[model samples]
Target: MADGEEVTLDGRPLHLLRVADLKAALESRGLAKSGQKSALVKRLRGALMLENLQKHSTPHATFQPNSQIGEEMSQNSFIKQYLEKQQELLQQRLEREAREAAELEGAFGAKSGDFGNLSHLEGIWVKFRRIWVI
Candidate 1:
């Protein structure tokens, strides 16, 4: 609903609706890519579909290996385990991204790549504006 435009669905924003609308939208896209299984798509599609529920502009949502997410964070055993694993993965990724960002910063100080330091995301628009030209 952001970065991309949103359209009115029956006089209301499409995002105001339920998971059903999301399912329909995704299904309407057709053709599944090769090498990926349906189960993975089903869960991912479900989470993205659920994102329509968020009122906030920024995407605070992330995927758990087992599907159900964020506000719908599941209490199911498998989902719980998956969520814990995902937290660990997120921590590791944050650490890695921070390290990579530091390395990139040292190399060019944001004069080169988009992958540079981002301790303050405030300058993202400035960087992105520059980045988007290429």
Candidate 2:
């Protein structure tokens, strides 16, 4: 934000960039690539600062709401209503998903039932199935 101030592009300090990366950036900007890492960082920073300045030169549009107290109160009420509606919808969706999951588990016996518990006397059910085809 100031002269000679280092900015990070990807969490790593700009001055700590690899020599090859610094050279690549310099080359891209059509700057001299024969300099040391510090010189490269300086050049890149200068180029980036100029670019930032150019970006800020453009005029930006800003929101201008009604200054009247009644209109401001209406805008606030509208925002509150929208947010409350979204929250209620989210709560309803969560409740419905939970209920559907519970119904599925009950219908499928996923949580409470286990086939291993309904055992016969030491493989009696297997024998019964073989003999009693009906």
lDDT of 1 by residue, 11-62 (tens): 5554455556544555565523332344434543444545555654575468
lDDT of 2 by residue, 15-64 (tens): 88898888887788898877788888888878877877888886555744
TM-score of each: 0.28, 0.38
Poorest 10 consecutive residues of model 1 by lDDT?
31-40
As a TM-score, model 1 comes out at 0.28
lDDT of residue 4 for candidate 1: 70
lDDT of each: 0.52, 0.65
Candidate 2, which segments miss by more than 4 Å at Cα? 3-5, 59-134
In terms of lDDT, model 1 sits at 0.52
Scored against the true structure, residue 34 in model 1 reaches a CA lDDT of 33
Q: Which stretches in model 1 have alpha-carbon errors above 4 Å? A: 1-74, 111-134
- Cα deviation of 18, candidate 2, in Å: 0.4
